[model samples]
Target: MAVEQNSLIENYSIVIVNVAVAVIHYQDQYLLGFRAASQHQGNRYEFVGGKIDAHETATQALIREVSEETGIDIANNIAVKLGRLHHDYGDKRVCLQVYRIEVTAQQYQQYKNLSQGLEGQKLTWVEKQKLLAGDYDLPAANKTILAWLQLPTQISITYPLEHFNNASNPMTVWVQYHQEHLQIGALVYIRIKETGTEESINQLLHLRNDIKAIIPYNFYTEKADNTVINRQIVARHLTQAQLMQCSNGIAKNDIPDFIIASSLPLVVSCHDKESIDAANQLAKACLKHQLAPVIGIFLAPVEYTQTHPDTSPLGWEAWSRLAELADIPVIGLGGLSPVMSDQAMLHGGVAVAGIRQFFK
Candidate 1:
């Protein structure tokens, strides 16, 4: 699945397709079907879904697809929009609207013994870790799906100050708060926006062993490569420009393997469709190069941010549009509260993220 291949689509005006793919999750396992060798992109493990009918919504198509393929009805289940992917298979241009629905133990067990889909396609349950590790052979576009799967729905990003705005030792307070949050299983992005990110990450790295962090790339300069940053809390953030650089490197086969190979995952701060495209391209490059793909992206300014006062927020409507373009998980950031996670998910975001609201 990680082998690199050359398949270029020259024509840009081909008819586009809408496909509804489901990632049915149960106890850290995802249900997948093994395509027959006669099918396109055959012999690979794939999620069960099909082209959406002209008369149906994405949800309607997904419910129908899952039923026809797996004999499992998802009409009553809550299908959360995971991400959207637009890919060209040369023969077909497809826009995949991916959704994830969790099944209970009873439901999983009921279908677990089936061994094959209703269409006679082989079915297997890939473990969460194996899927995340890029173990199973999947279709090329599924590289983005693997990256998105690594992410937790809830994320917490640190601010210079959350509730303690007046503290002389605000970074200290942030350190304590972030450590506590991480210990409790909150996936926190270690960013100290006010006093600078470097020193803050250095401090956090030394304080604890259990800290799960996503460091950011320094927004101040292009000189700082993947090697420079503490690889901290931004778990180093990539701008669209930076992701473009990686994409270019993948083309030339000259990019360093550290970022592509590291335990640290790339998370981009995307404000528009173009940025999401850049990130998606980088994910494809990683899969091509047999390296670790981008983990996810942060789509920000869901509301006005007091920290970044000048940058306007992308409200729910605009944010949803951008999220629909992202093939990776999109965390709704800026001026958001934990309570808004559901709202974010409803509007195509994987989760809501923030400093002021979430930290408090």
Candidate 2:
């Protein structure tokens, strides 16, 4: 009877395995294919690849799958592992390992013409903007992979500066820091802490010179709803009160028109599950207003000095689960530092973000 019970459990349980997916990028666009209309997720668009064979590496599986699906041989070394996603489809559970496959412009064009759907699926090249704006419907599980692709690998946030205007050589500090970490693809965010007032507004402009000195890629000011500056990504950090305001704005279709017209991408911060849900809701609202939404979360507290000692950290497993739920690029915050950047990516973070990590 015990043997029969064990057999029943084995037979009823779902099979677990890995699926390799290719994210082929060319000319600021990505390659995606439509699933066959008869399959389980038929008539939907997805990154193309197949199952990983027994004892096969992710790269080996990617090369084989790309060739079989698109008739293009992706060089093994050129395929960079982005991240992995754990998904369950009731009867089957899978770890979808995604890779970024690189190809030359001429090679991409030639393959675009020559590539045939080996599995009777339709293939198309899509711009990143279209993908973010919901131009195509993707399978629920694959959304996390798309979001991961949108995030920068490194992020640096500023520490609160109450005496920046009186300090000497502030710009030098910024210049030296940028020179040291220039190659890391870092985005700088100037944290905004203020109430509406003339003195506070004037004080805010003190860092403008230092900000301008940094290279003009991915630099932005946070909590920027009141002012629109040049060459900076305007942002808003939502608290409980502001979140209710956002909800009302979305419901009344009253999110300001400037959001849709602004070229700067929007970043939203989430501290807990309630804020995470609010961020998700705010993202959809941002999309409706033609704004790009990126979610930031405080997943862990590394040191007692950083926050409450009794507060439990989310750790890697919980962080990954919460990030998957975001369905948009997520920046890992809280206790993260430069050393844990790679580990952050492993657990589904688009980038490692912190105040002390990049600033003193």
Candidate 3:
């Protein structure tokens, strides 16, 4: 946790605007507004929110903003912090205090009946698939918000693909785990560690919305169709090495084929600041192409693991420091459990991922 944040606002001569933003939601639908052509971020759709006042907390500001924008009051709705995003738009910089508001059935209906914003903006409920497809023109600044919306608080990754090959029914345990997690609204990532096993890829693809698929770079490069994306599965998973290949920039060099064809967000595995920097560069490159950016990275080995007894764990303090370097979301991996989600978020991560604890 950072006790003090040294800002360049004074040095850079930029006016920083602090605003409270919300992603109002109900099940798979999100409340959005189609901005008038005359307004800022004109003609593009945006989440419902407003600027915060000096005396108001982010939550208070959001509640007031929601009430002002729409007739419904969200005083009792659960608003989870998806983390903050600060953008420098050259003229002025805006620091967004973004939150996710999970609305109930009646609230969703109330908003649905309200055809237009109280201020004359058009209101609509867009499905998750449409948002994933970039069907609506959202400000590029909201790229990370899109990533946060796509990610789950708890991620369940399957054991190595080859480990299940010997079993008569390779998908048996996976199916069981998928069902269990699905019941709880959690997601499953079927990791493909082996190259020659193409059948596993097909089986994983068949998962559709059942299990949000996340495949390794090699597997995606070889078998991912990309012709039509379901928007449910994560686009691709970049290993640290694969990510390093484009360290210079995705501009002059050939952007990876997977990235070029992707309509879905990407996931990267990062450890140190160097890898995180690489992922950040990749994300900026994706944003330029109107492609979904690196939604999050799996920052690993926060604690000692039997898999790698020799290597030292990051522990909590060092892990938090590493997480601070990543502007995007971070999922703490390696020797962690679901119970540690709050600890991970408190330290700058969005969630924790592991096979043992999640599967158990």
Model 2: per-residue Cα lDDT over 212-253, one tens digit each: 111111223334553533432334344434555566666667
lDDT of 1 by residue, 1-360 (tens): 011111223465567677889999887988989999999899899988998877778888889999999988888877777766666577876777788888877788898776888889999887899887878888877767776776776777775555566778876776776666553545677654454645556666556544456765552232344333333332456765666666666556666555654644578777777777777776656555566556677888889998789999889999988887776778888888888888888887788777656543
Q: What is the C-alpha lDDT of each candidate?
A: 0.72, 0.58, 0.72
Q: Which ranges in model 1 have alpha carbons more than 4 Å from their true place?
A: 1-18, 54-57, 86-95, 104-106, 161-174, 181-183, 193-203, 218-235, 239-264, 273-292, 309-313, 357-360
The TM-score leader among the candidates is 1
Per-model TM values vs. the true structure: 0.74, 0.52, 0.69
Q: Following a full C-alpha superposition, what root-mean-square deviation does model 3 have from the true structure?
A: 5.4
| Candidates' RMSD to native | 6.3, 9.8, 5.4
Compared to the true structure, candidate 3 yields what TM-score?
A: 0.69
After the best TM-score superposition of candidate 2, give how far the Cα of residue 26 lies from its true spot, in angstroms: 9.4
Error of 3 at 253 (Å): 7.1
Model 2 regions lying over 4 Å from their true place: 1-22, 25-68, 71-150, 162-185, 195-229, 232-241, 248-263, 289-312
User: Could you give candidate 3's per-residue lDDT for residues 156-238 as a string of tens digits?
Assistant: 77776445567777666555445454424456665656556555455444544455667665565433565333444565688
